[model samples]
Target: MSASSITSQDLSIGQIFQNFYRVPDYQREYVWSESDAKGERGEEVEQFLKDILSEFEQATKDGAPEYFIGTIVVCPGEDSVFDLIDGQQRSTTSFLTLCALRDLLVELGETVPSTLAGQIAAQDTNWQGETRERMRLDLQYEDASGVLVEYGEGRGKNARREGTRSIRNLANAYDTIREFLSVQFPSDANGLRRFHGYFTNKVKLIRIETPNVSRALKIFETINDRGVGLDAMDLLKNLLFMKAKQSDFGKLKDVWKGVTQAIYDAREKPLRFLRYYLLATYDVDAKLQEEDIYDWLTRNEAQTGHGIDPIGFAERLRQSALAYQNYSRGRNPAGGADHGIYNTRLLGGSAVKTHYILLLSGRHLAPDLFERLTRQIEETMFVWLIAGVASKDYERVIVQAARNLRRATDAATFAKFEQEFLVHQKSLNMQMFRNALLRLHTYDLRKFRLRYLLAKLTRHFDVLAYGEAGRESLSHYMEAKNDIEHILAQGADDDAKLEFGEGADSFELIQRLGNLMLIEASLNRVINNRPYSEKIATYPSSQFLLARCQAAPLTIGVNDRITRAIQKLDPASSWDRSAIDRRQQWIADAALEIWGVPSPNPKATSEFEMLIPSPNP
Candidate 1:
């Protein structure tokens, strides 16, 4: 052996990065700080700063140079480089902090220390007498492979958004660190300089280096649960190693890395992944919680086949993670656009992530069958939301259905699963769906549900009518600023009332599902206050086909979907009460089909269809 056991050195943040790091592809992504829709920052990232700032204050008063943060385990590698086995998250944050400090110091007009820039990336003449440099942290993982270098080169903001969760987290962490620095220093340049000095020189962590990856991983498993502890993900990895034989550690670690990286790339949580895996593989109906994930896995190791074949289980998990990543990115097994998979994300990024249980349950099925399952799951979720089915009730149905879904390995079985379980006709009443459609307004959960509904509606027609959005992913619609457009202005003018009648002035009419459509926010802002006559012309400018369908000339295609729905709408028909009813009725008819709700009253369809004029006869 190189030594009796291993070597350890306590080093400050500045000292640790003196040698560059390459985070092996198996490590988790930069997740110490994640920004979600709920406006919550990563608790650990925030706490990282809060705790450090407390130490910074005392260290400043005491003029101390060593305030320990945590530990990092690594395997020594070629040429002053190290393969980071543990503490990539903390190390990545340290690298980012260097970037933020330099950027913020420049923004605040403080002289950046020569050492700070050198820590991020060293500049020196090589043996050939030419200048060469490299970033201190090199992330070799997919998803955000080149992002660290981009930050090092001072182009962090320009990092592309390909729906890569790691890039988003990295960008968010940089901004968060910059913000923390600004808040702590305010207008005092001297205070800012002092804080930077303390951060680089005082913030310390223990670096553990081993001769090999296996040794480093073992060392990591030992101390990771203590002091700025590792997340459930790390502990689970340790659990996998514990159950496997010595000869299989490398294989187990390889698959485990793929499992974790896939989940991280998808922007999903590891514990969430573990919980869903348990459900899809073992107890789909058990009220498993995320916090209880490790405990559940340990208890059910034998039942889940993990104890029998831990390597095989990891392989299965790797497959599930790959599927989860595809579903997260809105791709089907065949790598084609699956609206069913896309709509869940378009519904709500993380809120509707549980919808993946169905995806995971039937992943081993044929591509067409898997596609059918996703579509059915998407429809079931919509119906549940529309029928005002309680979340717990919806969860119950999907969870139990997922257990049976794994058995639906063929077309016939999938059809049976769809009919017996996914079809929610009995639970969702036609009239209930109709009234729910009428009652739809921006309130309660409706804010997100309404966006999801409108986005789906626009996407459905866009694909059906023109076949244009076929090339555009749901992300284009999702990332783009979308607004819930009100056709009738809320503050009714005299012209609006006279053109549409007295009831058109009512807030209820203005907020109705029929009157509302999805439009790009920029377009909405321009026409938002205009009257129907003035706004109808600008509807053609909207990115949304639904919004553009107001006038006949807005479209040129003779596609039968829109033509039969309304054979070239008249350019002269102003936005009016009759139009709102017709639009609402159109949506109600589609809603029944989309969500698989029971048919509306037969007479009602006839009454609604009459609003669309007949062809010359």
Candidate 2:
């Protein structure tokens, strides 16, 4: 590191706002959360204001006549401009204080002067210097995007969206400060004059000069340190820089950056950055363990599988990112593509769960079968999608499902699950699948790596999942109650009986897909009310449900296609043309390895079990 001394004058809220100081183009967007620093903005703001107010109150009580809220930073900056590296928050709050003062003065019918210290109310002769000059009535301000904008009656107009917009909750802090200002100065002309004296004459801003941008950037990083936190983009950015050829790096970076920027700019926060990252890079299949995926990201364990060199992995990421970008932009690869990952929020709903479901559907089964399973899983978990979910439990299910599949004893066990899945219909299978995942997620989130849990909790997935208001509610809920009920319960009046207790009369009333469909819903109401075998045999809608699922998209992997198809066939009836066609094609395709011959030749039948497990066995 090169050493150079840069001098910049301490600047006030007015100065910073006048220039609209922003994170530099090269700087990462604001990734800090107070929680990341082990602090709460509400508590921090409350204490900060209380301290300032206490100082002011004591100063007045002591009859010292005056005190000001002022602080100076000695750091680096460019010639005439300096970054507010040290005092951004304080400076912002103070500016807000001034705004509140301006609002109050206007309400009070004061004849304000058109200059600093005199803008809201006339400046006193006692306050005649830099504060006076800087606080002038017509001071313009900058925005978070570093755009120089005018600030007059509409200072809040067209404010650029950035990460700190959420911190605007601190506006409550401004409201409190304003109330104190109003209380300190009485309403009468003489008393109001006293208030003006305290505000204009008592509020002083000090300036320190700084000399270079680089030094200022470092100093800013130090004083307002948001030390190492998991920024998903950082890894991707590093990968792009390190792996992309000099020739393609710029284009690749631009594409990746553009996608992230579009998300953040549209969403107006950095959380979307994380959302896009997961959608673009994270792929989870039933055969892949969640812990394995997490390990892939953090420990580079899974990345080592398939002998995937860093260069090769980076190439794949680049391809995937490009594919995602195209899908995001509505450009089809061959005419159609899946943007389900990008469009679905990660919250309580099973988008991530569905992702794994779909992944497994595709990975273990052929593309056609995978699509079918995906549709079934989605329709079954429709309620989860609509009701929204608490995230911790949501991820637990996601990770565990992958873990379970990765541990499968052999293709047969995997085939058995697939056979059961098709026999029962995708909806019923998915309901059970999600229940399994939820149980796992709950266990994993609490007991797994604390570091990973923390990162998962802090991730940007929520921005897409819960959204702003929902995010707030979720935070409040988490802070207040550590757990969220995964199952939506039946109303008290419901008469249906259940294993645990009285259940909802209708599936609509139940939340858990497992409880609602497989056991409790009207579709399975008879089954749950009766014995399992009787219900499966006599249920009026069972065959219709399976037929409907068969028509839907296939979502299992290439390997599972034969198994899925065979599971759908009737052992007693003459094999239909579709089944025969599928069997014939299966034999010809090189993709089918577990079974060489697809026909019912005795040898083929024996070998078929290797590829497709019996639903009963």
- lDDT per residue for candidate 2 within 433-527, as digits (tens), equals 23332322223332212122222222222332224443332223223222221122333222223422423343432332222111113343333
For all candidates, the clash counts are 0, 50
After aligning candidate 1 to the native by TM-score, how far in Å is the CA of 59 from where it should be? 5.8
Q: What is the lDDT of residue 487 in candidate 1?
A: 76
User: Which ten residues in a row are the worst by lDDT in model 2?
Assistant: 608-617
**TM-scores of the models, in the order given:** 0.62, 0.40
Off by over 4 Å in 2: 1-51, 63-86, 111-209, 225-617
Global lDDT scores for all candidate models = 0.71, 0.36
Best of the candidates, lDDT: 1
State the lDDT at 66 in candidate 2: 42
Q: Write the per-residue lDDT of candidate 1 for residues 247-345, one digit (tens) a residue.
A: 886678678878877876777777788777778777644576666666666666667777768888889888888888888888875567787788766
What TM-score, to 2 decimals, does candidate 1 have?
A: 0.62
